[model samples]
Target: MMAKYGACLLCLSASVVGSAQAESLAISALGNLDLSYTQPQRVASYEGSPLPAQVEILPGNDYWISTPENIQQVHFLVGQGQRVSKGQAIVKLTGPEVFHYLAQVEAAASLYQLAKSRYERNKPLLANGSISAEKWREISQDYFTTHLEYEHMQHFMERVHSTDAATDSLVVAAPVDGIVKLNAISGPYMAGDQLFSMVPNNSIRVKVNVPTGQSHSLSAININQCHIAIESLSAIAEGAFVTAWSSAVPQECNLLLGQQMTVVPEYQKAVYLLPKNSVFSWEQDSQVFTLSDNQLNALTVDILGSTPEQYIVASDQDLSQLQVLSQSVAAVKGIMLGLGGE
Candidate 1:
């Protein structure tokens, strides 16, 4: 009887051990358990710190002055930071070709004057029958040719005279009366090349570098639609519609030409932003692991919007109940059992 009882006890013990082993194996198959992670309700909470930038303003109507002749080796009209005006002479140029044209005009004028005198004298002779009609006609033709030549010479001289040599000497004038910003001196530049730039004062713009993903968000908003706060001046500037974007990833903004500025772009859309690292892809689908019943469950979400530092997840999940993993979770054994414990 004792032996039989011991055999039964041993059998029972073996069965218990096997059952426990089966249960443990089942739990291990589930992988790691999801822990409660702090998830912000709003997407803006996930946005990373704003990028640092210096304040910059917009540029007014400015232009670069170049040489008229379109030749090289011409002197600059003004030095850097020199004010100028419209139609004001900025640069002066003198060349051997200019003098050559002037001499040609003088010679042409003298010959034309002599021809005019002969034509005038023949006109009377032809009427009086002192000279034959053919001879008079020849003198008339000469007069016409000389007169044309003289007029051409006069026009040529006028062109030369229009060239400014002294005050407007080789200097470029501003198209508008504004500050002279840049004057490039001591360079071999071709004619029509930019020699200087001008900009009006106090034209500030808030330039921001927006990621490609966030480009659509910007489109919904109008230019100068909102006011921007300048941290340095503690002042607010009204936004204005400037120019459209140029590049996919706009690294620079022209708040001030050649200057850097910090800007915060306000989006019209309600975006659920999050840290870029917090989001992961699984099976070609975007997902975030959230803790439910003390176990991690892959939550598929639609990406409503995103920036470099954050992701905006669109989902129907009860956000109040869902908790995402802030940090990468470690592999935990028997995770399935823990989830199924309840």
Candidate 2:
């Protein structure tokens, strides 16, 4: 709001009062200082110290697919990095294991059928007291047990591959629409190894590393109160709290899996978030100038934490008289000294 750096006699006007409306001070080669009232912005501060963190590519549960077992003669139907629709066929596979599994399933099916037939034939006999209750119960148990076994095998076979393969080989499809990992389906792979990795491509989180000595502060942080600044990229983002963890690495980021990072974790405590330029230091006291009755007064503020451009301060005084200064306040002490000499 400053029009110009209007000159005033320090000795004559420093202690005086007037009806002149509060006006901003503008200094050339400097900045403008607003005389308008501005109260300190109060916020919750985390006393928990900050520690090094890492930005990790967390695999979302949306559809993290992996190979179930050793697959033989695996051939991917899609190219690497190709977007695949949910339930779309992604791979063709064959293995001796599938045939062995199918044989067991067929055997279980035959036993189930025989037991079911015997149970049905005895139902009338048991009702007419032709068969003992104990015998009927034994037959029912065998039928149910075999039926359950057969169903289990059938379910396993259903997932052995997709159902639409033209050959005897098993076909596997993507569980969600995602880019196929080009290298995942070229050759046979063992069970439990990564088949492919995909991200929602944009959904990501930063995991901050708190040393064993400092992790005690983690309990106080909630998802919304955490902030992560990617040091290398100069990007900052809020964090969503995580309870569970995974080991899957990100497919793409200008980051390594083990890169260290910094996270600004916050907790609820009375404090102020202020621009660094607004606060000034004198001797041992860090203060900000507040205006009242057209006079400037300084209030001591205890700084709690600071970022490159902000300061978190803990103070006990009321902020009703606080004024936001727009011009450089580095010379505030010099003005105060001039007043003392008056």
Candidate 3:
């Protein structure tokens, strides 16, 4: 290293060096620096570190499955994450309450048929004045009450079907196409207890919890190197973090519901990516040394973000025409501070 800066070091050294330096200093003065230069890379966007993310179902898309009857025994026909279509059986049930309901429905059907027959047979008699009006009114009332009970039973039957009449077993079918999210084990469940839960394919989304200080205005996230556009972010904050939400992934993404994965946030903006060593602090401002006409000139820049090896920065002046010092920054700074003369 060159030791002799002499009086020039004290006279020229300044606290802050701007790009307007008129002195065309020779590079040889900063001895054995092994200096190197690099051009800043102009990019439209850059990716940050991978953040933890999870696939979740929106609250409005949750479908809860329950029955009014006490479930003494339950057998799940489908597993978690299993895709199913409407009318597909999801669980089998066998309980005293189930059988009792079936028996009651059968009895209601029989009584409805008997009432209907009597009503039809006596109608002509009433019309011809052969039967009293009071007696005809009684027949009409029986038919109406029995028919109402039978219709209610029929609707209950639609919710569950008899898988084995002798065994008193019934199967509950899915009401819509979706994937099973919460599946109950083969055990007893109280009346109205949740037996299963599901979500439609299009209702799934990616959720990411980002630190409050970082940028949250993101429109896309990368998973497994595939970029997926974000639909929105939660307006409120959860303590020190904010939640970012992504739209439903397409079939081509091959992402499964309830799957957890890392995601990289991406945004569109013009920025310059420069080497880490090329930048230095000058008067609390980030500055880089530019080489032109054999002279080193310091230029200030705004640091937007940074990685371990690169700093994502922005500058009002066009940096494309200037070459930045990529190496030997510390030695150059010491010389500029007049310390090399010691």
- Taking all chains together, each candidate's TM-score versus the true structure is 0.34, 0.49, 0.63
Candidate structures ordered by TM-score, highest first: 3, 2, 1
lDDT of 1 by residue, 1-342 (tens): 000011111110001111121112222344454433667455322221232343333434345443333334455456555544544554445554334444566687887888888887777877889999888878888888878977955642432314442333233345555446554567555545565555443333444544443433443111222334322221232242222222111223223344443333444343354455556554345656665554456556666445445555555665545566556433322343364521
Better of 1 and 2 by TM-score: 2
Please give the distance, in angstroms, between residue 195's alpha carbon in candidate 1 and its true position after superposition: 4.7
TM-score of 1: 0.34
Stretches of candidate 2 exceeding 4 Å from the true structure: 1-71, 79-83, 95-107, 113-137, 160-167, 177-277, 282-285, 291-297, 302-321, 324-342
lDDT score, residue 22, model 3? 22
Clash counts for all predictions: 22, 8, 0
Worst 10 residues of 1 by lDDT: 1-10
The predictions' CA RMSDs to the true structure, in order, are 19.6, 12.2, 10.9
Error of 1 at 202 (Å): 11
Write candidate 2's Cα lDDT for 1-342 as tens digits: 101111221111111122122222223312244333456676544444444555455544434455555767667788776656766777766777555555677799999999999999999999899999899989999999999999966754554445432344667667555455644545567766566655443334455543332233333322223433322221233342323222332344344434565443433456665677777665545667666555566666766565456566666765533665534465654555554511
